[model samples]
Target: MSDLSRLSLNQATIKYAGMEQAVSACLRAEIPGIGLWREPVAEYGLRKTGALLRQAGLTPTSMCRGGFFTSPDSDQRIKDLADNRAAVDECAELGVPELVLVSGGLPDGSRDVDGARSMVLDSLAELAPYAGERGVRLAIEPLHPMFCSDRCVVATLGQALDLASRFPAEQVGVVVDTYHIWWDPTVYQAIERAEGRISAFQVCDWITPLPAGVLLGRGMMGDGCIELRRMREAVDKAGYTGPIEVEIFNQEIWDADAMEIAELTAARYVEHVL
Candidate 1:
């Protein structure tokens, strides 16, 4: 097997491609697994996408998401819980062992970061058991601190691990994405602390002059200052032996040919992350 056997293409890295095309790109690039998003999977029909992965011999390493429990409104919180349950069910159907969670930010007009994080804990306390019953691990992903107010309140690997520790390791875990936590001074220590709680590991470099919304500014591997290989080694040392997913969310990368992007991603993974 090639060294890239553990490399998985995250569909968001090639958001322009359809599910079939993205899986095809992974196959053509000889990648063994894929990290899928819920939107396209639902659009293609969950059962159909599951069948496609089976036929193509592609492993669904992790599902994109299933969390947004920071809302203050009771109705909104109920809706978020319902949606996350559905996502858990879909994860079971897709045979993906892990469902990535991007816990929502503080509710509108609210400045309570601690309260929002507590909400996340409460939400996970409810959903983790449901996911565990279905054999799907909830992988809590910590977005960068810059997104603390808008995207995710969980801003560090330590925070993610702390939240995940509330549940059984098999049911809840943390995702150590290089793009988000590379700048942290205590990241390596957190990785060691995570140990068996890492469910998925994602790679994307960080770049300057973030875009208007700061959502599409992820740099491709090796294009920025993140020590991709160092982070990978840290996760490995933490006892994680799963797919290393590439999840870049940039418009320029999306504009490129999907196959080219896959090929280049493979090369970069070898150069910078292996």
Candidate 2:
């Protein structure tokens, strides 16, 4: 088991578990890392969550999210900026290294993909300094193209690398997730370009023949066709030795016990990828 200690379980993998219970599972599984979501932290209270992680001796690989930078309404844009600033504060408070960002999709009534992307770039330019000042690197996660219209504007590793190039290495970077970007043709090349700027690496298997409007269909490792070992090799080659965070969001997994999910994920990584 090549030190499954480096495996982190993103809390969404066990959404049925309470924040504290999830911590218990991670601790029991000997997982050294975790990735928390803003809502769960808010629900459990950030200070309390941080204390829980500390008690469990777990460090967060990165916060689950903090970037929804595209909106048609100027007011909404300002709101997103304010929200991300608060996210930065939360990440700093927890002593986490990175804030994962899912640059949001096009504004209402707008289909101009380029314009939406520009908005995301401008928003990051404005927010990166704040995050940097607080010692939090913003990790721009490129969602799958399936989410291009409604969930995220950034949809490829190549595009995310391009976005990171606009900011300082300490301030901005890319997060590679097999579930979201494995199908990208230039994925491996993009990872090489990422190099030191690969702020985070997430894992989740991909299931084909997805249904319409499906927002949470992430499969577990070895349960789907994703070549996680190859992806991990790519990440290691890209110079990122960070935790491989399992971030499954499937209904079946989310409804199961947290400890079971964490254990299974860790075992799979050790057996197939490590």
Candidate 3:
């Protein structure tokens, strides 16, 4: 299985499974790691989630998100920053070190991409020290350009790195998700530039004929066109030796048997990512 030791099944990959069920699936597959999300963690109870992962011997890789820092309203910005601080506290309690961030897109009726990006930077400047104090790193994850309008504004790895470079590497970093950046022509160079800033290395394929709500269109490791292994090698070459999370978001996979999906994910990861 090409050493499934470093493989992590992100909870979103099996969206139907609750936290306990997800842990059980990981155990059955002998997967050593798991990437947790905030909602499920809250549902399971933070202290209880920590206890369960510790008991099950599964490592908490990274948290799903802690951003949305593109608000133009000062009140909304305050709320977002508070929520992020809580997210950082949650990560510290759960023993997860990386908190992935998706920079929010334009505010209502606003089209200034440059201005939205500036808001992201300013918000990060406010949260970075708070996160660093809690021993958590804010990993800026630039979504694909398709998501630039609503979900994220940082569209490239270089751009994500530019934002990360503004803060201490221990405080702010970047997530290199294969499905999002594999199509970028200068991805390798960006990875090189991201040496110390690569906080998380996520893997998932990009499927064709994207489903509605494109957020759920991610494919299994070998099911699409992304060069999973090359991306892995590039991240490795950049010195990020952390858990490789399989964070796919697809309705079909979510509807399948959780354990079987996990097994298939592991096998495909071995075949395609390693």
Candidate 4:
């Protein structure tokens, strides 16, 4: 078996599990790392979650998201900024150095993707320093273009890198997720450019016949068309030697037992991504 030391199971891969169950599954699989999201962590209580991970000998490889920065309403924008700062604080408290960001899509009915992207950059400008001060790095995750209207406006690794470039490497970085980035022609080049700023690497695959609600379309690695191993190599070549998180979003997978899902992810990671 390939060394499983660096395989981090992203919490969403077993989305139905409670925090305790997620940590337990990671331990059972001999997975050394996990990618945690704020909602479940919040629901479980941070101190308790921390204790559990510490007890299980699992490191939190990354914090799953702290952005939605494209709000047009002044009041909402203020709230968003404050929430980002809070996110930074949470990462610091939990000792997670990387805080992943999914830049929100166009504010309701707005056609200006350019405008939405600009807002992402602006939000980064404000968020980077705060995160940096707390020893937390903002890792921008560019979603696939299909999500540009409602999920994330940052649709290409190049665009994410462009915004991240405006800040110091320590303050801002980018994520390399195979499921979302595999289709980009310039993906390899972008990975090379990310270099020292590549914060986290997440793995999943893209399959056809996406579910009507597309948010859950991500396939488990090796079950779809993504060049999972190639992407892992590129990120490694770019100097990202951190955790490779398994982050599938299929409801079918979620409906399975968490332990089974975790074991399956580890097996697929070794077979398809190692």
Candidate 4 lDDT tens digits, 163-195: 999999999999999888899999999999999
Measured on C-alpha atoms, candidate 2 has an lDDT of 0.88
Candidate 2 TM-score, C-alpha based: 0.97
List candidate 1 stretches off by more than 4 Å.
none
Candidate 1 accuracy as lDDT: 0.93
lDDT (CA) per prediction: 0.93, 0.88, 0.93, 0.92
Please report how far candidate 2 places residue 52 from its true position, in Å. Answer: 1.2
TM-score of each: 0.98, 0.97, 0.98, 0.98
Model 1 over residues 1-274: C-alpha lDDT tens digits? 3498899999999998999999999999989999999999989999999999999999999998888889999998999999999999999998999999999998999999999999999999999999999999999999999989988999999999889988999999999999899999999999999999999999999988888858898989988999888889998998999999999999999999999999999989898898
TM-score of 1: 0.98
Candidate 3, 147-197: lDDT as tens digits:
899889999999999999999999999999998998999999999999999
Clashing residue pairs, backbone N/CA/C < 3 A, model 3: none
Q: Any runs in candidate 4 off by more than 4 Å, and if so which?
A: none
